[model samples]
Target: MDTDIFSLRGRNIVVTGAAEGLGRTFALAFARRGAFVACVDIDPAVEETCALIEKNGGKALPLMADVSNEAAVTTMAAQLEASADTLHVLVNNAGIAIPPGRLLDVSVANWDRVIATNLRSVFLCSKALLPMLLRSKDASIINLSSFLALVGLYPGFEITAIPYASSKAGVDGFTRQLAIEYARDGLRVNAIAPGWHGGTRLGRERQASSEPAVIKRFNDFIQGSIPMGHMGTPDDLTGLAVYLASSASRYVTGQTFAHDGGLTAA
Candidate 1:
């Protein structure tokens, strides 16, 4: 059991949506493992994430850009290329879920916005960064997906947005196709489909917009559905992320792993 296989020493990595939540967690985890992390986000708060990494004796760079915007992504790629000769890993963790509602009740503008932010951003970032990624001996692209992509919620729950679910499904398809296309080049593409995680902005936004009774019902239903009987935290996904970014999973590619509290199984 040589644990050295899990080391990410000297590797260069990029994590989008790193201003907060799971993206911040992934950036910190990689930096702690001795990887040089570039924390990218549209929010200026991304500097805070980099500050924390530096506080802990880790190397980090904060880059501001809207990943959903092609021009912005192109600029970000250029900045990254100037900073590093090659990129070892890319965590496509930037995504947004609009307010939860039924399909017909949702507006067309919101639907398109979700798609652009969640699905299109993955494409833009990967395409812009392909050259840098290809230069690495071992490159991996880790896309953040959600369990909602695989199954629909109970009717009238309004616990999940239609556009959000659809965008994540697209991410899965993109991951599989890209994985096959780049396998010959030794670039692995994979997705992590998280379920019912607490302490994220998504959960908070949903709660803030719902009535007390609706919130209670949503919470009760979620708790009852998960076999583990509890929601996960951002920390729960860190280990899986590290595994995917490290050589420990060099042979793995084009797979979507559910980090649900056994919700997907039950």
Candidate 2:
């Protein structure tokens, strides 16, 4: 069953925010499995990611674009359509985590940026890529959500702002709607609500802080607190991703895959 289901050969995949973190990891994974990977990111570092992919003998194209901008997404889609004709997988992974602040104390500007960067980008990118997706024999839109959306764990260490959590909730909701609307067209839409996988810059800071005692305490707490007894790595999510992107999850749609290492389970 796995053999026939999880093959991504000859597929064209687009992964946003591929400059670093889980986005880059996902992009590389797809490329490794024989997909033509289009690595999109707002950061110039994406060129380095592109080079790495080529160095590995994998096909990759790096594109710079603000996922939040409709115009940029449109242009990117056009370029992709001309090159790939159709896209088999779309990974909406670009996101922003603004400074922590109370909902009332949060600036309207910050709220706008969070919504645009984290939520609107998913809508814009997917809308622009829909036609190309529809043309594919099989297509899937995979949005990166968070366990915060599922368990109401907002007010991250950096910001107490509600915008980030609110935006992710919106993404989860949008995934369901998109799945329903496009299921008949052989398109599946799903969201992955990952638990505390430490990849973000802030997460790294937390792990490597000068406050050794404090960091140690936090680490111990995390290890004992989570049902899995440890934090998850980006690689831990690849199997789930491969399932969703490949034929393995043919009947799976309009659902959230919580890859939280038993946090959600507990």
Per-residue C-alpha lDDT of model 1 across residues 214-256, encoded as one tens digit per residue: 9888888877889999899999999999999999999999999
Tens digits of per-residue lDDT, candidate 2, 28-145, equal 8888887889999989998988888898989999898999999999888887887898899999999877655566777889889989998999999999998888889699999999
TM-score of each: 0.97, 0.91
Using TM-score as the measure, the top candidate is: 1
- Could you tell me how far off, in angstroms, the CA of residue 140 lies in candidate 1 after the best superposition? 0.4
Superposed model 2: Cα runs more than 4 Å off: 1-3, 154-160, 205-220
Model 2: lDDT to the true structure: 0.85
What TM-score does prediction 1 earn? Answer: 0.97
Worst 10 residues of 1 by lDDT: 152-161
Off by over 4 Å in 1: 1-3
Q: What is the C-alpha lDDT of each candidate?
A: 0.93, 0.85
